[model samples]
Target: MRTIYDIEYLQEVTTEIQDWDYGLVQGMGVFSTSERYAHIELKVYTRDHYTDQIIWNVKEEYIPADLSDFRDEIEEVLTFFGNYLYALKGRREKKLVYEVIDGSFCPDTCMRSFVRATARALVNCFNKERFKPSPADLNRIRNSQANGLELLKSFLTHASQEEVVASLKNVSLTVDFKALFTENELFLINENLYNSIEILKKKEISQEAYFKKHKLITKYGDISQIGMAHLVLILNRKDLLPQVGVFQDEEIAYKFLSC
Candidate 1:
């Protein structure tokens, strides 16, 4: 009995794809196969140990006929990465981060991180539908003064995957990202200061009115909207201070503040 497509024939047929062209995989090892269209296209790896791997065997019919849409397609891929970066802002989990950037243990901000580059590369499958800034997104910095955090939002508003890559390709991305980031930082800082002052108004202590205003913006005082505000008030009001209040760890508070 003879088979319609002999399994042994794949060896010879694979050599044809291997000799002249290299697309699906780099070397020649069966990585995986797609049984989607009832036609089996085997994924193979080339001899190169690194940097040579084929994704899958896509048919010629599946290939895009128009080059015009290619730009948008590429943009979608970039936007996927951008969204990924957005979602992982507060996430410090090393394994969670590892799942994003592909073995990328980003030690830049927090502790050591690990992400796989494959996640970044496969991002082509996920993309932004369209570019639009949500009102809730713009309001983030309005409530907090984290500029680096704010710019991530604005980057979504004014850019898409294509827009970012195009700007970078043109060498204008740095200037644009910086300018936008600076504007957001400044605006957010101002808003934080305004809000911080208002938040303090509820602390109605009679001993300090004029002095409290001056102390807040002073060099000795803390300017942080949340953290430093509590510190400033603690030092200013002896009764409300951690040492006098029902502190969970009064000794720790006293030692930490040196008060």
Candidate 2:
């Protein structure tokens, strides 16, 4: 069975299909014109060699009108990250299939889709500020990630497509639409969420509903801060557990509920 979902404003997103894996995520209010460029949360699952591990992962994709070519460099940025994860896991090359499990309590809808290195990059970027380097200066602060986010942020700030493409030199990235768009029908969703304060700082919002929905602050480099954790404070609504996301600490839970 299949059903179509709709975003409140954009209706062309009305075309969608429900299969074994994805449920009804057609086109909800992900890309916000106001506060959030995009924001979404959903429980997910990943299967290991033996048992399955459920995870709460999100995709943070932000593009400003400044740089029209930001979309093209997505693949290179993600590829670097994909290489990074495999290296961390002691694997060398890119593998065609990666294991993922259902993160929700409900049964697997069997959404026929695979994850991407870029999606992982989105996770990294959504983690926090200072997560991605800001300056092109080689003597960047020590103990930092200097992969490709600095250039991404710069492109978003300047909108200089040529300059942004040029900045990719450091990471060996190029702005070509070929790598960014794929043939597959399934699209990756979800990314780490930002706070209200951070989202307000950027000069790009055009909608009011996004601000009302408690959307997190987001930027282009969001994909840069994936693996790192920020000194973030979570609020436990006591009733809003599922919406808040995964956390394995009493203090985090306590601090969340206290404030």
Candidate 3:
């Protein structure tokens, strides 16, 4: 059976977009049709090795002249429908395929550039929102002093779908090293000390040789803002230092740690 998803008013479209692919399913499609009005089609199909059955085929059509204007509304509607379809996913009883196809006289030119881009953006948003952190991971994000929650929020909202999926999959790994140090111990290790020690370790230099090679900027115990900021930066890198907290921006990290 076929249906109409939803209709909306004109809004502008942006040019920059990435393709949408989730698991084994492709989320975007553009097709050639008779030169009349541009059409966007969304479909859900249940398939097995031998049989393919249509669950629902929903479509929305727009005038070519109006496509540019209604682009924003188009995005909203697409996202909404995408979410609806996402809710239907993960039914072990059936294997489903979800698709957004655009029909245009020049599918390559019209749908490929605009409607397809919108679909991709919607998919990206979904990929970002779909991730659910474990309870322990949530505690880490909460305890993070570097603004870890904000970094996670920004990553989900702004990053590409692939980036969101791949980078966040092992987000817990960023803090795995924390087990080796107490929170106080980690906080005390300033960037200067860390960097110097790292160089010495990498070069297999003795502590005496390392001290002789590099000039001391300040006494090791001095709590300089640069030293503190660097400490937070390293700890908050990718929010990897789970105990240190994560910041959405470096400037924020410097400000939060300096004070």
lDDT of 2 by residue, 25-133 (tens): 2111122222112122222222333522222232122222233332233323334433444444454332322212111100111111112212322342333231122
Q: Clashes in candidate 3: how many?
A: 11
| Residue-level error in angstroms, candidate 1, position 99 | 18
Task: Please write out the lDDT profile of model 1 over residues 1-259, one tens digit for every residue.
Answer: 2221212323333334224232332211111112111111122222443322223233222211121232233233323433433343433221111111111111021110001112222322122121122354234312323343332222222212232223223323233222322344434434443343334334333434332343222222222222222432322432322422224354544443343
Q: On a 0 to 100 scale, what is the lDDT of residue 108 in model 3?
A: 22
Measured over all alpha carbons after superposition, the RMSD of each candidate to the real structure, in angstroms, is 21.6, 24.5, 19.8
Model 2: residues with Cα > 4 Å off, grouped in runs: 1-36, 39-68, 96-259
Per-candidate TM-scores read: 0.19, 0.18, 0.20
| Model 1 / residue 211 / CA error / Å | 17
Error of 1 at 5 (Å): 47
lDDT of 2: 0.25
Q: Whose lDDT is greatest here?
A: 3
- TM-score attained by model 2: 0.18
Native-structure RMSD, model 2: 24.5
